[model samples]
Target: MINLINISKSYGENHAVRSFDLTIETAETTVLIGPSGCGKSTILRTIIGLISPDTGKVNIEGEALSTANLVSLRQKMGYVIQEGGLFPNLSAEGNVFLMARYLGWDKDRIEERIDELCELTKFPKDALNRYPIQISGGQRQRLSLMRALMLDPNILLLDEPLGALDPLIRSELQQDLKEIFSTLGKTVVMVTHDMGEAAFFGDKIVLIKDGQIIQEGNISDLIKTPSNPFVTTFINAQRNHLEIIGDI
Candidate 1:
């Protein structure tokens, strides 16, 4: 279980997140969905320790996320950013093994883990030598997943993981990712602007506005009995998408 208790963050004078609170249970896929700049990514970053919140703290599996435990705590979590975030200079295998190598994993051990992750992400072993530029957008995402899962973390944090792909590729990845999540049973928190994606990927949806949670529930609960006008408005804005994706 993960607890984001009373979390808040700011950028100079702008508040990115405000008094936010959320609990991510083990094996559940929780999605942070909202409009652009609504602080969805900020929450993910804060949870992953990419940046500290101005106030409050995070807890993973009953352990507090502090300086003393951050490193060790992070070892139990995997993070993926938009478009794979792969380094240009490294090959797919290199990118996947970078962290393991830094942790002093032996060559054979690293290779074994890489092979396992490749199969898990459904990536071709022969293409491991290819750089980020040499692969398709979808493939880069698979590589990114492989890297994130190489350590076999219990929690997965993703920020717009499929935001860059074309509709066809994006649709394919969405299904694949759903299956992957179901198979892994890892706690997941993902940020996305697409309601369709949220409806499809998330077991529970958390909608935010002005850095605060507007509503948190499953798709049917939000659509059938909205807490406020914004909930209705937000869903109406993406009605076509929700219907097209057969989510409605």
Candidate 2:
């Protein structure tokens, strides 16, 4: 559903993305995994138009990204960043309906969407009136997810959505998120440094290194027939943890 072609970006002399090319399939989850500063998030931001590549282009459903179409294209996408990115001042319901209200959605329609999202994200109705600080970390992330899905966009872009949570909470949310993605069948692109998380959520996993794609495939593909030495090294580095989670 989204494609990045020959993309390159640099900050000062450091290349953030180098000659990158990737296509995210429709109704499937694509996980971008790498070490910190490897540019996976940069690629995600590029797809969402937050970062313009110095070279190459991004295409969403065959439409090339440009300023003229950026706003319209963005409305079709739901973005959830790390730590939930919720407004501390806004109540849970307020945060979820922020965009809907801005777009002039009628009260009934907004409430209906919020109800659906709350149920989908397993957020409590009683907590809707609470602020972000009043909720637990997991609940805050759920609220972030609700806010993203309030518009019912066709694509979901998440950058380390579960990175900050404790392991147990993160595991629980991973299962919940996987079910949500399967139920919705939206195009999903997520970024993480954890191989276990990638294997759990990704239908296609792209392993990146030094601003370049080192390998792209299923977890088994990377384990069995690594594209390069770095691919093997990356996998082995996380193999023990992956084994505890079992094969995907």
Top candidate by TM-score: 2
Please give the lDDT score at residue 178 for candidate 2. 97
TM-scores of all candidate predictions against the true structure: 0.94, 0.96
Q: List lDDT for all candidates, in order.
A: 0.91, 0.93
Give stretches of model 2 more than 4 Å off.
241-248
Per-residue lDDT of model 2, residues 1-248, tens digit only: 89899999999999999999999999999999999999999999999899999999999999999999999899889999999989988999999999899999999999888889888999999999999999999999999999989899999999999999998998899999999999999999999999889999999999999999999999899889998998888877877765757875
